[model samples]
Structures are given as C-alpha cells and as structure tokens.
Target: MTLPTTAAAPPSAPPRTFSAVLVANRGEIACRVIRTLKEMGIRSVAVYSDADKDAKHVALADTAVAIGGTAPAESYLKIDAIIDACRRSGAEAVHPGYGFLSENVEFAKALDAAGITFIGPGIGAIEVMGDKIRSKNHVMAYDVPCVPGIAKPGLTDQDLIEAASDVGFPLLIKPSAGGGGKGMHVVEQAEDLASTLLTARRVAASAFGDDTLFLERLIRAPRHIEVQVLADNHGNVIHLGERECSLQRRHQKVIEEAPSALFESLADGAAHRERIGEAACNAARSVNYSGAGTVEFLVSDEHPDEFFFMEMNTRLQVEHPVTELVTGIDLVEWQVRIAAGEVLTVAQSDVVLQGHAVEARVYAEVPERNFMPSMGRIVALAEHGAADATVSGQQPDHANVRIDSAMRDTLQITGDYDPMLAKVIAWGEGRTAALDTLDAALGRYTLLGVDTNVEYLRLLINDSDVRAGHLDTGLIERKLPSMEFRHAGPRELIAAALTLWLERPGSAFAGDAWKVPDAWRVGARGAWTATFGLPGAGTATVSVTEKDGSVTAAVDGGGPVNVRVADRSGTGLVLEFDGGLVTYAVGSAPGAVREISVGNDGWSCRLEVLDRAERLRRMLSGIQREEGAADPEVRSPMPGTVVSVSVSDGDSVEEGQVLLAVEAMKMEHQLVASVAGTVHLTSKPGDLVKADQILATIHVHVATEETANTGQNTDKEVHP
Candidate 1:
C-alpha cells in the first residue's frame, strides 16, 4: 500500500533564523520543544516510532516523520534514521530531548558531521561529561568537593568488599557509567557488598553496555540538590540557583523544589551559594560546557556546610520547570540561541532567584502496589492550574499552579514508554504557600482508568517532615510503604461503589437515562456481576446484591472514583448509603454513563456486559466448596515472561517459598508457594504465562481421614 503524504519541494528562500528544527524525541518533551519552536516562529519537525503514530506530539508538530519500530533502540536512538528525518523534513537543526540519544556523544558528532546544528552542548562537552568516571576525574581536578570514592573500573568482588570497608559501612556500589539510579545498590554492611556488586554489575551491563562499577561512601540522610547552569560559547556562564530533589523512591526523584530550606541555615548563605555555584561552573567549564545543564550535589544535613559533587546532566532535566518558574527564564530558548552563535544575554550577577516553586511528577503507577508502572488509556485527566484557580485576594500574584502535560481526555497511556503523564508545579512567595497550593491542587486534580500516585504525592506534601523541609534521598523509601494503601475514607469508598453500580449492565441508568424505576434492580441481584467502562480506559466489574430490599455494590478493580448523577425530577441523588454522598446527575438514556466534571476533574463511567463474570464467579465458588480435594492448583496472577522456575514435579516445598520468578515491564516478581506440599510444576523457565494460567500444583500429605479433612478446609480458607 502506498503511504499518504503532503510532501512539497524544499523552500527556495534563504535560511531565516533556523527555518526548521527536528525534534529527536517523543511524548511530552517533543511536544514541549514544538511549543518553543512555535513561540520562536520556527517550524517544528517531529519524529515518531511505529507505536507513536497517534501520539499527541506527532499531531501537534508542523511536520512528522516516521522513523522505525516502537522500541527506543529501533527508532529514537537510531542516528541514521534521525538524520534522515532531519533531511526529509528540511530541518536545519536537531533537538535531543533529555533521553534516547540526548547524552550520546557519537550522535552529537554525527549531527555535526551532517552539518545540522544540535541544540545542546557541543560534542566535546558531551564526550567529557557522558562518562561518569572521566567526569568525576575532571571535576575533582578543579578542587570540587567530589564524593569520597575511587574512579577506577572493573574491580573484582573481593576488591569491591575491600573498597566498601575503606569507604565505611553503608556505602554505594554504582556503575561507572550510570544515572537515574540504574545499576546502583546500597550496601549496609560488608556482608552485603559482594552480592550487591554482582547485581549492580549485571544490571549495569544490561542497561549501559558497561559492567564496570565503582564505590562511594554513602552520606547518611543526604539531600539531593542540583544547580541549573546556562553558558554561551563566548566564555560566559551563570547559575540559576538550586533545586532540592530529596523526595525520591528507589533513587528516582518524584518531587523537586527550588531554594531549599537547608540553604537558609548555613551561616554564610551567599558565600556558600557562591562556592557551590562556582564549583558547578568549574565543573561545566571543565568540559567546556555550553547551553543548559545541571550539576547535581548530595548535601549532608548533619554537616550542612559540606556538599559533594554527584554528577552533571549534559541535557535539560525532567524537573527543569521549577527553575523556569522561579527564575522566569526559558532554558529551551536559551539553548536554541546559544546553539545559533548567540552570546550570553544575562550575566551571573544579573541572575536573581525569587519565590518558591515545587514540582510533582504524576506518573501512571500504583503507589500501593510497589510503584509498578501502569499503562492504559487516560479516560479522564483533570489538571489544576493557575488558569483554573480561585482568586483568594491574599497575594496579587497568587495564581500558584501550573500543569505541563501532553495527555487529553482520550489519550492512551501506553506501556512502551515512561509512565509520567504530567508534571504539576506550584509557585508562591513562601514555602508554606507553595506547599499548601501544591497539596490543594493535587486534591483537586482527578484521574481515572489508570493508577497514579496523586494521593501519595498529597501525603508527602502534607507530611510534617516534608512540610518542615526535613528531606533526604531516603525519605520516600523510609515512609512510602507504610503510608500508601491505607483505606480511603468511607466517602471515597462509597463514591467508588456508586460509580460501579451506575455502570452495571441492565441498570436502569445504563445509558444517559434521566430516570429509573424507584426500586428497579440493575442486574441479576443474586451475586450479579457486570463490567463498567471507566473514564480512564479500562473496564471493571461491579458485584451487586439485593438482599433485604437494600442495594449493595462493590467495585472489582483498582484506582480512584468520582461519580455524579441526578434524577428525572432534577433532584441530585445524594448516594449516602456507602458512607459518603455521591452527587449524581440524571442522563437522557441508560447508555449515558455517569460523568463527573468538578473543576478540572473530568471523569465518566459507562456500563458494559461481562460474558465471563458469571462463569468466573461460579468457578470460584466450586473451588471453594471442594475443600477436601487431593490436589490443589496454583495460578498466575498476571501475564508475564517466566524468568526462572525453582521447582520441578514432585519437589517438596514449604509454604511461602518462591516457586518461580516472572518479569513484567522490566521489573521482576516472584510467585510464592501457598502451601507446604509436593510441587508439580506445569511451566518452565522462559515460558510466557497469562493471568490465571495453572502454573503449578501441590499435593499435601495427610496422616488420617479426619486430619486430611481439616487440612483441606484450611487450604480452602487460605486460597480463597
């Protein structure tokens, strides 16, 4: 089949300030670049993978080019394809947006050789700073306070243990060429050193194509701070203050803010700022850095005066918006100007940091379920911003909120890329105001269909420790597991139940119906189950019961809920039966699912029929009743690739033993044995398994008939 195109011959006009720019990225960042281009009156060109044909960024660009396959390696990282895209789109420059080929020096060199301007630091700077070991050596040469560690690579397990001992207990074993905490492990004692090193090396090899690792003395309760720097080709550099990124989980930053409170405690704030700023400048100068970059430091809270250079990101960071908000400087514009042979517009002394800014990344992940990446369609996204805020009249400039997002009401959150859906930022004159604004915005922002960490973010912003600015890299790890998954209030639960009930099949309110029989049953009220199409992009089942003339419903899927409905009489239904009042509006038809539009919170629920709902329930009931069965079967929880199988047929295993390991979405999970019995494994390593697939079975030995019956009853209770 011939592909459709609106191709035209190249323009005959001479180049007018970068006629076009090729965005060598995807998703929000690509969209961000295109927005900047449009502001500068430059045409924007977008490149897409096979999977991103319908992505938001592609539709937003002036022109789009399809590169290759869905995966990063096959498309975004393919230098030749990117260069070809630039040529096809008549783009005079290429912008590598923070990932894929952003830090790849070879790609920069290739762009230079192809005579296309790369809108970032030059190839030399990228080469120097891309290698962590080399960058460490370069920074240390300038008397920067470097982390206490060695830069050598390829150390044996014994050497690693000895290095850890010298660095002291609780040191970090990190890959020599790593960032984003990949291939890094924390060793609490000498005994854990060897295993941690091996794991780190393996992970590093797979991720960065380097198995070399290094040791660093982990600073106890260290807060992560990074200074944003912009430099021109004409030997001028300025620091844009610091961002405090202490709230992180598994070495990934979830929240970031500007002008840390810890900075205020230092005796000589100006002097300390100058010193750190100078160090960051020197580090940038070491690589002859130009354009926008961030120099990260791990500052010790115990010894507030002391700080060590962590690493330098050669590209714009994911959390650069907070800096932009407080400084009122567009880093992207500067990057474009610098690449076009422009001199520095602002001097170091001219730069002034003002106000407080906080940014929270809203990711498609379940905070209650190990922060696992979630993927699906964003049925509804309600983003709270200054444009939608109420005027409080307290501060003249207190609009306070900003949302940077690429998702719309019907966007799909695919599993093929990063799970971050949006970045929400709040700016205020003081820290308290910023924190309060951020918390309130989070509370008002509503998302449906996929799981997100919105509630978790709210918890963090409200926590006494976070509010008081007592933050560190380990804060989330120390507090998150206990904080997440706590029950939502009864009101929220009732709202979810009502949402489910309204979306059930045969419910008089199935469509956009305004009225239903006063006491009409929605479905088969006896253990009835019907799927509900949620606003976000998935279907969930609602089990309804109608015993003793009372209606009861339970939602059988994850994520939050917001339901609103009204009756034909124009009276809003105050669904207060489930401990909360779910305000709803009546619709014209039963097919018109309940939709809730509160401020920026937009969500809807559609009723659907589930063919297997009844069958599954019957199967579960039958399994529960067969309590004295001789053999018990085990099933898979989710679809995944089996990474390992530890047991074979006839292998005796204790309860809670790991029977197999399955990998899904780059993370590993173990399937544990639920009973102490002889294992009969049905699947082996490297097999792809589906949810509820019988992976294994176990047989329990019983001494007597009575004891067997008792054990069977116990098994049924435990499994159920």
Candidate 2:
C-alpha cells in the first residue's frame, strides 16, 4: 500500500504561501523534501556541492544552484552562500532538511535577518534543545524524568573521571552536539574511562565542533523510543505517536517502526502511549518549540511503563517515514504549511494510528567486516515491489517499494557524506504483516558494484528475538555473534568466472567457443582453469569443462557440478546452476576493468578474474611466505585519513595495543597491533591512506620449536 502524502490545505490570514522555496540539503532527504514541495505546487530550489552536480536531488528540483565544493564545510554548511542563493532565486522560505543546518541556531537567525522564513522551530528553541547537556537540564523542571548522570557544560577528561563514581560504573560518554551516535562511547569499567574520554573528546571536536561531553548511566536492556511532536508558531503542538528505535548497533539505529511492540505487550498500552505522548508534548512546550521535532527517551525492556528523557532531536529524524506512514500525515507538508503560518486543523482526537509500518536503513557498508563503509559507483540498480517508489519528481530511476532514495545508475558514492544510501519502509495491516513485508522488500532490494548491508539487514530482521519484538538497545550487538550471514559460494564464484570469460569481445557467447580468449579451444572436450580474487583476502580456483552442451565446474579442485547460463542482460544474468534457476545481478565499473560484481538472494560479491600469469605469480609469492609465521605488517583495513596515532615510532607494544585510528565515510576504525614487538611506523596523524596500505610494521622475534626449545635463539631467527 502507498503512503498518502497529500499536501496540506490552504491556511488562513496573516500569512501567504510562498511561490518558491529552497532546500538546503542533499541526498535522499533532499529528494524527499522536493517531492513534497512539488505536491504543494511550490517551486523547489536545490543547492549542491561540486560532488553533487549529478545527484538525484539536484535533478528533482525545479531549479538548482551550485554552492560548489565537495566537502560539507565548503558548500552545504556555508550559511552565507545558501542565504545568497535563496535571495537570488527569489525563494521566500527554506527547508533545512535534517543534517546540515537543520538545528543550527545561527543559520535560522541569518534567514530571519534576510527576511526568509525558516521551516523549523524558532532560534531560541533550537539553541536550547540542540545541545544535549542544555536540553537535559531544561526539561527536568517540566517534570520530565531524566536518566541519572553528570550532565553539565565543560566537563573534561578529569571532570568525568573524578565524577565517575557519583554517576556509577558502566556509564556512557556522549557528545552534547550531533546525532547518529557519531561521538558516543560506553565506559564499562573504571580502568577504561580515561582513555575512552580522550578518544571521545577528539571525535566530538572533529565531528560536532564542540568537545563538550557528559556522562550517563548505561541503562541495562534499554529500549530507545522517540515521540514525534509538531508545533506551529501559533502555540499549536501535537504528538504523532512514537517510534520504536531499539534495534541499533553501536548506538546507531538500524531499524525503526511506529507503535512500539513493547508497548503493545503491556496490559494498558493505550494509557502508557498517552502518558509518553504527553511527556513529549510537555518537553516541546517547555522549549516553546515549533515545527517537526522528536523527543527521544530510554525505556527498559523489563519495565516498559517507566521511561526517562534522553534528548530531544531538534530536527526531523531519519526514521520519520514510519511515523508518516502509520499516521497518514505528511510531516514535511505540514512543516511547510506551519512555516507559512498555518493553524492546526486536526485535533488530538482526530489523530488516529493506523496499520503498522517498519523501515530499514540501507547503508553502503560491509556488515560482515565490522560494518566498514563502502564507496563506489552504482554499477547496477534494481528494486522490486508492488508499487513504484513514491515520487512526484525526476529521480528518474528507482524501483517500487516505498523507497526514499537518491540512488540511480552511474551515481558515485563518495566519502564526502554519510554512507546511508536509502531507506526501505513497508506497511501492513498488523505488526506481523508489516515485518513480513519489510523482510520481503529487503530481499528484493538489489544493488551491485558496491558492498552493502542489505544481506545483514535481512538476517537481523528475521532474528528470533527481533521477530518476537524482544527488543533492546544492546540486542543488535548480542545477536550479531549468532547471526549467520550468507557468503558467495560455488554458484557465485562460477557465475562470476563464466560471465567475465563469456563477455569478452572475441567471446564464447559469440557461438564460436574457439574464438574466446583464456583457455577456450575447439576440442571434443574443452577445459580451462580460472582463478578469481574474492572478497577479504580470499581466492577461488574453478576448473570448467564443456562437453555434450552441458557445463560442469569444479571449485578449488572439488567435485564437478552442472552449470548453465541461460540469459545475460546489461544489468543481470539468469543462470541454472546445479539444476536450480537463479537470476543474478551482474555489473562492472570503470575503476575495476578486470573485476565483475554478482548478486543473488539479497547478497552480492565482487571478484577479479586474474590473468594466468598474475595468478601464477601470486601463487608462488603466497607459497614463499610462511603460513603460520606472525605477520609483522599492520595495514590499514580501509581507505581513510589517519585521525589519531596512539603509539610512537620504535615504541614496544603488546599484540592488542591500539596503534591508531582511520576515519572514512563518517565512521572510524581503530587499528591495533598484530603482534608484541617494537613498531616501526610509516604513517602519522592526518595522513590519507588507502585500503591495505601498510601503516606500520612490528619488528618481532620468531624461532622454530626446535631452536626455541633447545635455547639456541639467535639474531637470524628474529623476523621483522
């Protein structure tokens, strides 16, 4: 079923609808806002950085202005440039869609000074509620219960350590600014408190521009629930129910839904919903807030009735679609209407919750590898569902299924912004139906050429605890160890090899098998061995032979299995492997000429078809390197800038000591020592390194069992 996103009705006097409006954002949210603007008959102006000239949002808007820079600070965050664009375009209002300047008080003030309407809460409200420390202190007077913590301005590493006991053990260190769990860390024990604070403060300063942090008691088995509140300039405030956001990893929400399943299990669920909704409204009223905002709360799974105020998000949340789908209210249209000075026509009694809706955030990440951010070109794109993706605009290529995305063919995914590509939201008559719809949609969400978390998301949503709504903040971490993620097996490997070999110019697909390159020949039985470089330092060798018009393939010299390719298109291929028909999404990117990507059943893998000479060289080199010897080299796992280096050159460290951190795509990965030895560093802070680039080498001593046991250790036995 489609989510009805009709524009709001015309409002009364003292204000007028603007003919044009500017959206100061990028990516899917920008595209989402422009859709609503079109429905309202308002001209939408899009501002883009240099990197986004070909982005979906820019093409969707009626007019586009290039603020012109790839980095956020150079373009989207430039307040003066955005104001100038608005003035030049004759736009009377601007929608600060979430991230960039949505909660920025100075940006709102600048708009007001320029005589432009800001489609959000007032500057005072943004200022008070933007900072987590201030918002927590401000809402307590209104009787909103807050978690016990040492929350105040200017708490340093020492301040937190000294007050650690007062706050209690197992406390959380959180940055007062920014959302999305960017600079948050949990200190489980007293011994790890100081070092975590140092890293937390550095990350906070780098991310939020303010290192101001506070501490909170880590709620055990806690569920994260947030209530959506909408307030107008005319003192009209209402709550749009609540969203269950407990399914998260590292405090980053992975899945969210409306009408908490935990609440539905309660005896008097309606009363509890009303109480929580009223509490959210009370928090909004205290700040004199206006426009769409979310009040987040932490509730324990054991005691579903008891709740505590966590922090109020002063702007629209990434999970707002679920609220819109369940309530049948277009929040963006209302935001524009409110900014145009409208009064609330629908009362609290008129606000009714409908069917359940669930949303899954699809990110460009490798979940199997600790959720590493993936960046590349969109080589192939296809989506399947009953309905077309909600659109009023020119996001030319996206499949059906209530998808809010800026994804398209050939669009480049870079590290300049967040790795979140799109959101897949589904609705049904009941919670079970909604969850089932969501899972099916995720399975149908196909994308290739870049690694994604889609497969892991399916595994997660189908988990026994998740399906049963045994939810908590730590549930994802707890379930991750037991979750089995699918990998590219024999079918995928053979498919990749055959597709690459068959697609050449003098190719096997051309009817003359002898004309094909590699090991093709016109003999009674044609046989060839192909080597492929798989993901994560893996390699697969497949031997193929053609006889009697049927192909049999053996992987790494295993038993032969039947394989057949029935179809091949620009985007995918239909193959019958081991007597089972499967449609595989296939693609290749310019950056990788020898590489090809293949996908099936919500999982995808990229493998390189190595030449015969290259494969032989690698095999010889691999043999030369001892298999069980301690590798002295520490390579960067990903391409990113070195944010922090913990150890100095020539410093002796233990095997597990933290050496440095690499930051890419808004996520940070800490690299640790591989073995106990003296580190010979090659990289330092602020160095931009590439994937598998050696950052350091640990000089270690290694000896054979015979030499070590005989106490004949010599300098020759030491290895570096």
Candidate 3:
C-alpha cells in the first residue's frame, strides 16, 4: 500500500511553523508529541493533574502547569483551565494528543476564538465527523458505502424502536460521539434492547459527555480497518494506507498492524488499497477537513472485499505509531505544518509502506483477573534495547524495536485515566518477522510494581490463528478463557527465600541463634529453617544445610537437593540448583517485601519471609479458626465507587449471582455471590469503598446441629 510518486514543482514559500506548542494531554501520548516538538525546535508545554505531578511527561516538557484534580473532568476536560495554561505558558498553539479534548469541537472553537492555533482538524470537521450519526449521514450523501441502519434527523424513541425492528435482531447501539468502545452494546434479543440502551446512554454521557446514540446492524465477526488521512487547508488530502485493528478485548483494540494483512489476500491488492485510500480522502474532502484525522470502516469477515463507513476520528489515533513506522513520515510534524497554513508536501503517489510494523499496548492491568486495571508505584523498569542504546531515557535506535512510553523507575501509576502505560512497536521486512520481534521485545521488557499484559500479548502474537492472520474483533474475548496465569514454582520460591537470607541487613543468624559461618562451623554444619509466604500460594518452610561440602535444601515434604551458591552481587544471586544455573534479581524492602525475578525469563514474584516460629504459630491459629468457621464476608477487590447494588439485605441468592458493581478506571466489575446463602449487604450504591472493605456477608446453611446453631461453615471467599 505505497503512495504513487509523481513529478511536481517546488513550493513558492517556506513551510509554516510555530514558536511554542502546549500538549493538552497526559501519559505516553503527551510524551510522543513533546518529542516531535523538540525535534522541530519548538518549545513544549505540558499540563498535568494532581496524580501526574511527577510524571515523566511533566519532566520532559520545557514548562509544566497544574490544571486541577486527578479525575479527567476536573482537569484535562476543563477547556478554560487548558486555555489559561496556554496563555500563561505563552504558547501560540495547542496539540490535543489523541484523547481528552482532542476531538472536542468546543475546545477547538475556543482555541480559535482566543487566537491560538489548534493542531488538528477544523471545528466544522470535528462537529460533523466527531458524531457517528452525523458522519455516516454526511458520508452517505457522497455515495460512500455505509452500514445500513437508522440515523434520521430529529428521530424519536419510537422511531428508533421502529428502526431497530427493521434492522432485525442482533443490532448494535453505540454513542454517536464515542470512540474506544465506550458506551457500545450489542443487543442479541429484543427483551434486553431497552435495558442495554439505558446503560449505553448512561455510559456515553459519563465518558463523552454525550448521551446521543445511534442504532446500526451488528456486523458479527467483523474486521476493523481504518485509513489515516492527512489534509491541508489548500484542499489537498491523502491517505497513509490502513491499520488492522481487529484484535480487541471488550470492544477496545489491544494489538494493531499497518499495511493490513487483508490487503495481501485481495487479487488486485494495489487497486483495492487505492479504492479505500480514495474513499478516505473523499471523506476528508466532504467535510473540508484539514490536518490529521482517521476514517474507520467495518469490513465483513465473510466478504473481505466489502467495507462500510463507520465513523471518522477528527484527531490523531492511539495507533498512529504503526502508520508512522511503515510510511516513515512524521504525522505530528505534518499536523503542525498543516495547521500553520502550509501546503501538503507529500503527495498521494509519494506515500510508501516500507516494512511490516506491529504495535501492542502495554497496559497496567492484569489479564488473569478479568483484565482489571492496576495502580501502584513502578518499583522497577527495564527495556532491553540494542547494544548501542542506553538503558535509561535514551531512545533505542534498534530498527526492529521502539518503545513509546511515559514510564520511569519509581514512577506511580494512578487510577485517574486510561490504564495503558506504553506502546511497544516492532518492525521487520515482513509480517512474520515483525511479529517475532514484537514477541521477543515483550519477553525482554520487565515491569515490576503494577501488573501488565505483556505475557498475554506474547501468547496472542504466537497464537496459531493470529499468526495466520485470521483476525476479527472478537478474537481476544474468545481466547481470554484459555489463557492461564503462570505462577512461581518451588525452585523460584527457594531462590526468593535464599535471597532474603543473604540480603536482609545482618547475617542469616539472629539474636541467640548460632553464627553458622563461625570459625568452628567451617567443617561442621546444621540445618537452618526459614519460612516464606507466596501471598495467595500459601506458606512453606525451607530447610537449608551444608553437608559434605555441598549445600542441601528441602521444602515441606520434598526431597533434599544439592545446591551451590556460585556468586552474590547487589540484589542478584547466581545459584546452581536442580542441575541448572539460575540468576535471581531481588529487591528487598524492610520487613517482608521481597521481590525476586528469575533470570531474563520475566518470571517474578513478591514473597514474604518470616521467622519459622512465627509462621508456625500463625498456621496453628489458622487451623483453629477453620475448625470453628464463621460466615465469610465478601470484600471489595480494589478501591472504587460502587456503581450499582443489585441485591438487598436478607436476600437469598445463589452462587455467582451479581451482588453489586464497582467502577474503577472507567471499567465496571460485578461482585458476585460466593455461595448459596442469605446475603447481608454492608455497602450501598454510590459508596466509595477501599480495597478489602466488607461489601457483604454471606451466611451459609448447614445440616449439623452445632453448625446450624453457630451459623458458620468452612467456606473461603474467592478473591478476583
């Protein structure tokens, strides 16, 4: 999907440029724009919330301004605050990087009214293409192929129901002004349509500040393809090929690739690419669009040749890096020039898709726990780059790998906005090679504090269906159930405990304990016992002894194994155990915070080390409590606002029944009943609960007279 090259005359004037530009966003995107601004010799201004006071983006900018609170509505979404910041910073232009106010029409108009340039499409284009309903209607007039649905002007609820009836069952309801899968629902049956519509509207209003929705026929198993369009005020527009964004989870894109694999399957691949490119250009021309934008399409899986108009994003997309990699074009630079009234420099024929490129979003979320978002300090960060690249902040020049991140060691990831921490892009001569590089990059990248989906992305890229390019929007959801969490094994545990033994301030021996490494102990030795707890994996007693010039170790009832300590460095130990050499990098905090990583395999765990006697006492006390079990209380898994309470006090519910829903990081999670019993609700709707706070108590029923009288059983609560 290369652009055609043609002979052209030189421009009569120099390209327009700005003095300073303010980035009205946060996180990786803000860092990305700032890098480009620095390359262009323009001053970069950054705005941050309370949570991002010490963020990487803030440090990268030439000047920083604190807007408001941690939440988006109080900060990034406040147009007045952003405008004032721009004025205070003396920035002549503003770049809304992808999210926040990037596609807000009012924001654009306000910037224009204040005599500051907006480095994106014009307000008219944002107003028309930003709304899905209007965008479809506007495109249809130009004879663009669009999905059949209802978008009548001034349509009422009855009109929507009538349209829904005509569209048949399995219709999709989406926010007219939404992107990123927020407030989108597929109603499989008529009975649930009304309820789903209500939820969709509420979510849309909350996320996008718009409750306007449109109904469309649900295209089952569809492939999502979007073409990047760059237009100039001089009426010149061109497309930078397409991005395949079919791999998704919960309707949001997780992995993306450029020069879509689907194009290679077409008989006339070049012609097919040209057709889509022209349509995308036309979409921009229809709205007199200027600067950077994206036109999205839904291609039917059964009919790859057929594509329908979905909507247009009037701002740079989150997946822009993929497009930039293949084209070797600086889209942000072009955006700034376009807004400065510069004419298009790259012609449609000059665009070329060099090599295959792929991008996988690294999010601070745990895939095993229903992809729940995580927040905490990033205790350790490692990005393996080329031999010549620096491990610190220096950008990697490896042709195969590129990390677009806003993360640094000791940085905190707060639950204020999107959970994505970074985007890892890999390029190669072909698709397979690119995917291989991506897989390797994910393996070498190490992130400690917060949970990430690096392993899940690795599994997905290697999946047979994914490798064969059999992609669809439902792939992640279909594959999620089969993905297993890799737990730390016994060998890893031993290394962890051994690391604690060596690194915990003083010698392995405590007060009154025999100093084993004494002058008399050179030839004689005895077993030393230490207790280690692997959080959810229970506790174990590790026995170590040096016998006959060889160290022997045992855990629980396991057989003794010969162990050799080769060397010791700062927080790193080289051990020869189980007939193999292993390296463990350990991070120790006072008390029981011992984090250990097993070699370069990216397998790590946080284990607690305690004295054997204390562990024994706790273990015995736990057994005593189980013998006299009580009703289990259900607790909140994380700090969040309770969005819905579905059950009432004294209500009898079955196992897996929904008790309430909690909203954290814009994602809603339902708390379910652990066992079939009478539920005593403790928290009500709209309550802000902390992690592990009691939400409800379930009293199980038993047949035994003693148990019935005590009203208790040995049922343990399952934490998700």
Candidate 2 residue-wise lDDT, 1-720, digit = tens: 111221335455665788999999999899899988998899999999999999989999999999968989999999999999998888999999988898889999999999999999988889989999999999999989999998889777888899999999899999999687778899999999988998888998999898999999989999999999988776767888899999998889999998999888888888888888888988999988888999999987888778999989888899998888788788898889878888766567667888788889999998888898887788888765422244221123322247888898888887779899989888877888888878887887888888999999889888888889899989888888877877779888888777765665554464654455556545564567778887886679988876777788889999998888888777778888767898888887755336778897788877777777778877885786678755678998777899999999989899889999999888989989878877889999999898789999988756667777788855232554
Clashing pairs in 3: 3-349, 3-351, 4-349, 5-349
What shift in Å separates residue 305 of candidate 2 from its native position after superposition?
A: 2.2
Best by lDDT: 2
Q: Which rank order by TM-score, best down to worst?
A: 2, 3, 1
Query: What tens digits encode model 3's per-residue C-alpha lDDT throughout 58-86?
Result: 99999999999988999999999999999
C-alpha lDDT of residue 42 in model 2: 97
lDDT of 1 by residue, 127-221 (tens): 77887777888889887888888667457777777667677877887887777666678888887777667667766775677787888888889
Clashes of each: 22, 0, 4
For this target, which candidate reaches the highest TM-score against the unseen true structure? Answer: 2
Question: Model 1, stretches more than 4 Å misplaced?
Answer: 1-16, 265-267, 386-398, 484-564, 567-720
TM-score of each model, in listed order:
0.80, 0.94, 0.88
lDDT of each: 0.71, 0.84, 0.79
The 10-residue segment with the lowest total lDDT in model 2: 391-400
